[model samples]
Target: MNRKIIFTENAPGAIGYYSQAIASNGLVYTAGQIPLDPQTGEIVSSDFSEQVKQTLNNIESVLVASGTDLSKSIKLTVFITNLSNYPELNAVFKKQFDGIDPPARSVVEVSALPKDVSIEIDCIAAL
Candidate 1:
């Protein structure tokens, strides 16, 4: 089986040793994306919703690089620093995942995340 590493300048580059996404079998799995801006190389915002929006956009870029997109995503994992932001996060997801069945998802509240960002998201998408 052939596996392809996915990368794009539209999203923030990986800070460590990992591809932004990988295509294998029939799916594209993405690394967790935070709110870092590709252009400035900094977290976009401190607000929870803003961070989520940026993270989603970053993940979208990775998916596009893999020749797929969030609309075709099969599963998602959201790591958040605060569960209190869950309702707002759902609103953002509803906006982004609009017109689609919405993928299977697991949201976890973690004590901390890289760069002290509020959220990080990753997904598996179908090609």
Candidate 2:
């Protein structure tokens, strides 16, 4: 199977030992993206909705780098620091995937995440 590492300046560079995404077998597997802005290297928002927007944008960057778009997403895995924010996060998710069918998704509350972000999103996309 052909495979390639994917990276983009539009997303936060990976902080650890992982590429932003990988493309193989006509699919793109994106790393979990936090709310940090690539240009500013800052978590742009504290509000749950805003944070979710930024995280989704980051995920989009990686997906684009791998030659796909949200429309091609097959699955998404969301990690949140608090389940209490699920409603607000859902609102953001709707806005992010606006007018498009969302992929199969899983949401989980995690003990913690890098940089203490409130949310993170990883995706799988068919190219």
Candidate 3:
């Protein structure tokens, strides 16, 4: 199957040598999305909750660019600097995936993220 690169102005561009996402076979694999503003390439907020929301929104933009959406997500991987922020993270996750059954998910704590932001999320979605 041929892979198609996915991109959109609605989401921040990849920082290094990567596309925002790629659609291959029947799935769309997104690069990890931080809370960076698409227009300015700056982290959206210092607050962890705000970071979580923006990250999800960024992922959604990439998905939409690929002709799908968060509701089509099959899996999600979250990177956070603090596991202690789990409750807030789940609250935001629930809000992002409120209607349908949410994606299968994993959360990992990292030593740091690009831009020193608090959270990042990447997902695999059905096309």
Candidate 4:
């Protein structure tokens, strides 16, 4: 199984000992992405909606670096600090997916997340 690491300047750099994403066989698996801005490496905003957007954008960047895009996503696992924000997440997904069939997704409410951010997301997509 051939494997390749994926990276992109359009996304925030990994804060730990991990690549942004990895492509193996015909699939790309991305690391969990927080709401950090790619250029500044800071949380994009304190708002839940903004954090969800930034996290998805980060996942998009990783997928693109792996020769795929968000439309090719097979699945996504979202971690959020508050389950009450699920509606906002769905609203963002509605816009992001638009006319296309959205990927399979799971939204989990955790007690906390890295950087004290409100949300994080990771995806699997076809290469």
Task: After the best TM-score superposition of candidate 2, give how far the Cα of residue 12 lies from its true spot, in angstroms.
Answer: 0.3
> In candidate 1, where is summed lDDT lowest over 10 consecutive residues?
43-52
Instruction: Give the local distance difference test score of model 2.
Output: 0.91
Cα lDDT of model 2 by residue, 61-85, tens digit: 8888888888889999999999999
RMSD of 4: 0.6
The parts of candidate 3 lying over 4 Å away from their true place are: none
lDDT of candidate 3 over 1-127, digit per residue (tens): 8999998999998899999999999999999999999999998899999999999999999999999999999999999999999999999988888888988999999999998999989999999
Query: What are the Cα lDDT values of the candidates?
Result: 0.94, 0.91, 0.94, 0.93
Better of 1 and 2 by TM-score: 1
- Judge candidate 1 against the unseen true structure and give its global Cα lDDT, from 0 to 1: 0.94
Error of 3 at 60 (Å): 0.4
Worst 10 residues of 4 by lDDT: 59-68
lDDT of 4 by residue, 1-127 (tens): 8999988999999999999999999999999999999999999999988988889899998898888899999999999989989999999999999999999999999999989999989899998
Misplaced by over 4 Å in model 1 are none
What is the lDDT for 105 in model 3? 97
What are the per-residue Cα lDDT tens digits for candidate 1 across 1-113? Answer: 97999989999999889989989999999999999999999999888899999999999999998998899999999999999999999999999988889999999999999
Clashing residue pairs in candidate 1 (N, C-alpha, C atoms within 3 angstroms): none
Clashing pairs in 4: none
TM agreement with the true structure for every prediction: 0.97, 0.96, 0.98, 0.98
